[model samples]
Target: MKNWKRRESFLPVAVLLLLVSLIASACGSGANTNTAGGAEAANGSPSAAAGSSTSGADGKKEEKTEKTKVIWWHSMGGELGKAADQLVADFNASQDGIEVEAVYQGTYDESLNKMKASMDSKSGPSLIQVYEIGSRFMIDSGAITPVQDFIDQEGYDVSQLEENIASYYTFDGKQYSMPFNTSNPILYYNKDLFKAAGLDPDKAPATYGEVKQAAQTLAAKGTPASFAIYGWFMEQFFANQGAEYVNNGNGRSAPADASLVNGDAGIQTLEWWKEMVDSKAAINLGRKTDDTKKAFLAGQISMTLDSTASLRGIVDGAAGKFEVGTAFLPKPDGAEGGVVVGGASLWILNNKPEAEQKAAWEFIKFLAQPETQAKWHISTGYFPITKQAYDEQIVKENLDKYPQFQTAIDQLHASKPSQATQGAVMGVFPEARQIVEGAIEEVLGGSKPVKQALDAAAEAITGKISNYNKTVNVK
Candidate 1:
């Protein structure tokens, strides 16, 4: 009986051991199969391997590709500069391939000088914003790549842009730059000052005679009146009187070596300025546009003629201090010549690699889009470069909120190319402006008669032009 019991116990123990071994073998085989399956899933296909490599060790997918850095040199400063920086940041965050770095190079003149110096050292930024006056210099230097070819290669629709804006950048049927922030002179007035001077706050001067009369009225009321008298402001006044400053719309056609600063239009324009100065109704504070703007904003000047781009500054500076009103720059009595467009464009530098050039072109196109243009225009008070941007519902809503924004746009539509005022392209224009400003100072200071001052200016400009032509080899 004891032997039988021992046999039963041993049989039970043997059965239990067999069951444990079977479970271990099954678990090991299943784990080996899973390991093989995982390896096959990852490496069985090229696309699968690529997908797996893009994930982190923790298995999270990467969000963005490496970005390409792009440098943009611009002249926009203050609030406009901040807005431009924000735009760059937004673009960088929205894309994986491009990262734009915006650097302010001071005023247009300063920016041009810096660009020239940088180009000499072959260390210039990949992109630059150059004023219209410097367009010829950029083209002549052969340092800039024609943007038209890139636009074509990228298949961007250039047809949507206004011809006038586009024409500003075109030389010899090729585009050298892309129109960016374009604006013109406009009449900015203080409504409270107008009312205090016994003039209708809503009634802006529509003609040069009206402007003079308004100035006299304002001065009679002991309200100061001033206007910024830059070369372009004087040029616009002459253009309004149907004067051409140069032949062939300032070389838009044939290459011309001379300037017509002594022409009838130029003389008459100077005479009008002389009358304003002699009457003492207009204050010539200084030649600087910013100084005049400051005077206007301080409520010392009832009105000032300056760039439409200055609208934002005036508004922000005068916030809760005065009501500002803007109007089209007045024309001469019964004369109706259109104004010219002013401001700058973006010029892409040559010598970049094809990929970098393509990336730059992409950025330029991105800036030209209606949404982007509208944002830029509203933020900077610059007129939108694209028609669709101006007509968009959002832009309209914003315009309704600030009607003054329409002043520049309306003036731009009335613009036509004129030789005297389309814009000066002389190599010595900077020097010529200093000479002209000196003559203006002489007239305003009562040191010289208007005609004498202008005659001297004309002689000086003629000599300067001749010298520039000799140096530039202009035929």
Candidate 2:
């Protein structure tokens, strides 16, 4: 075990050495300067090329010794990508001391895998936007400098940030990363369909029982509800019932050795979900939320669950067809728990120089500012991490224009701090989520009962956690 851990720890350096040799050999003939969507240095104009010197006013190349360069790897795509790029451009234009290059690196999973390969190498990013589930791995990999270090050194004020949003990125009484785009799951229902089914159009279903009742009524009227079989939803459901996902305070107090996924909450949720699907009240749309969103927009489904970040697209897509109503993620009857924040946060990598890391922190601070956060919220439909952002004129105007978004804000504010809402931390979270998803499919496909499926998934996840702990040398 010690030998294996030693090899695993040394793998990044070995890979880096091989890469350097390959690059040197290639440079002997020619070098490829184009940057693909991976973690290589940002390739483009001189100013955007990370660490490249800029020309002085005298038309002479200057060393740019006083300036710091930061390369940011991100996973945003499409309109969200555009918004992220605009933020980088704004940041670069705001100051001459720091040159930041933002690179879109596909999905979160792909970006994380690429980062794992690039860590401890020159090809790695100075800063990266990692999804919430990757937080445990980021900390365990020892590849990131916790933002708390900078916050403590610089006496940065964090009270202005949303407490619940910030709490997700906080672990062990320290802020590991700066909260950026944050969101929670919300239930989106078609008001028109509810009215057609003789249900209240103004009031959305607030609990699992209510959702099931609504689904039944809507299905009777030829409108079905579709909740995508998302593993995130499964996690949220556990939290919504005030249940921990793993042992030891959901891995916050100590390293988790077992998954609590087969608890009463998990069984209740699966049973409720299975009952709905079994009765044809709800449709199983497989694992893609996009597919469920399409069905909702096309009026084939009346209700769906998705991240609040999808508000803009769904609202605009259903603009003329139907009225969209948003509510808190449904919970079991009398359950007091709330949704855990979704979305990603900005992390400063340790592979970079202290100056570069500081430069990345500066950018993260700028993003946390009220003005920048308000713009980000408006552009991407992501909730701003800063509480002061709500006071921004643009944010106020936006909320007034799209009142549906207020439901998300209200839900966030209503949530009280708890282990469940703070979210679970585990080194093998990505793999565990996949395992849970597979178990859901097993239950829905009648291959296994709900409790049996959950038990199997818990066993699989525990094995993964054990392997991860062993790899990380966690006792």
Candidate 3:
């Protein structure tokens, strides 16, 4: 196991604790007065209220017709988004006192940025979809409410939800968000290319060594073996092979005190990547490709590792022109270890009125229902977060019709959560990933050795962590 250290300069955690303590103290009496500029009320628009109206038995107005509104910002689009929209609609219709409004907020990063800016300005949607990478930032911001507390306050059954998904959003003993669209990377291959390379299309490579051999064979046959050099993908490869990236997977308080990207496992992983690059079997698609997906769909590359979320787009874009097969990411020498979870979760903002908070919780609960989760998973290629959904007869039946939907679920089942593989919660991780990606590019471009590139990248990340820590107390 990698050494774990809480990031120094505990201001971020301190501030969070202080704010939470203050909120608890101020609201200790359980008073539900509206404060913080009535942002909650502003978000709970009149339309939401109107949409909640219902008729009495005698066709007269119901005596008690109060309704609460929940504004949600999400990045899911297309079929998956529509499925989510329908879930919200159904939830709203099922209850007369809560109306949940779902809005598309562009990509994951865009949604997170919007939420951050809104938090500083003291106004934003009551609920927003945050990628798992944004967990640390959300926790440090003190702008979001912990879902566990909310669940307790509302008397909801936390046990009803899948524990694994719940654990992903938990810090210490409390959960901050509810897992929504969870997924992991899988090996997507072009079957036609496999046949051309004389490999069994049905039998994808089961181990790292086999993958390399296949790549070599494909290259000898004049076909590009693989596409793109994704740092995160490589990180998962190392993790699945029982290697650590940062100490304790960047889960602790301070990252600088626990840097391990230059450790033995890290060095070995980088060397393996270098060997692949040197073999000329894999092509280094520039980070800013006009469209990497386009290249894959067009048969420019035979195999690639990416999020299962890309399934629908690739299948739709290909339009039944090519046979697509999905498999788990291969491990080195048939090594056994679980893959890490990717994708995002939905977080509820703090400072909302009691009524609105209740409504938000209601909507979140609805989203966690097995039917909704299964529908979302089937439509989006993201694994259903709840175990019931995964085992649902409906989902099982649909697997025959849409085989791609099962790949992500299989990968998730094969995954075991670890401090290293569960994922990194460090601040500025998106920026750090870009820096690491750039370093990977340099190594692939023959400008530097893998060890040197990684060392420089680690230094840069450590500097960023130090600078960020200075600005925000982490304790």
**TM, every model:** 0.82, 0.89, 0.83
User: Candidate 3 residues 222-261, lDDT tens each?
Assistant: 6555545555565677668666666544554334334456
Candidate with more favorable, higher lDDT: 1 or 3: 1
TM-score head-to-head 1 vs 2, winner: 2
Q: Is candidate 2 or candidate 3 better by TM-score?
A: 2
Per-residue lDDT over 1-475 for candidate 2, one digit per residue giving the tens place of the 0 to 100 score: 1122222132355543432232222111100110112333333223544455878889898764455778888877666777888898889889898988888776666576678677655588999988888787777666788899999998999999899989998876899999887888899999999999999999999988999999999999988899887788999998888899999888988888899999999999999999999999999988878789999999999999988888988999999899999999999888988889888899988768789999999999999999999999999899999899999999999988899999999999988789998999887776677778888889888899999999999998898788667656676
Q: How accurate is candidate 1 locally (lDDT)?
A: 0.68
The 0-to-1 C-alpha lDDT of every candidate, in the order given, reads: 0.68, 0.82, 0.66
Q: lDDT score, residue 53, model 3?
A: 54
Candidate 1 error regions (>4 Å): 1-55, 58-67, 417-421
For model 2, the stretches where C-alpha displacement exceeds 4 angstroms are 1-45, 48-66
- Residue-level lDDT tens digits of model 1 in 420-475: 44555554555555666677778778898777887788787677666544444455
Error of 2 at 81 (Å): 1.2
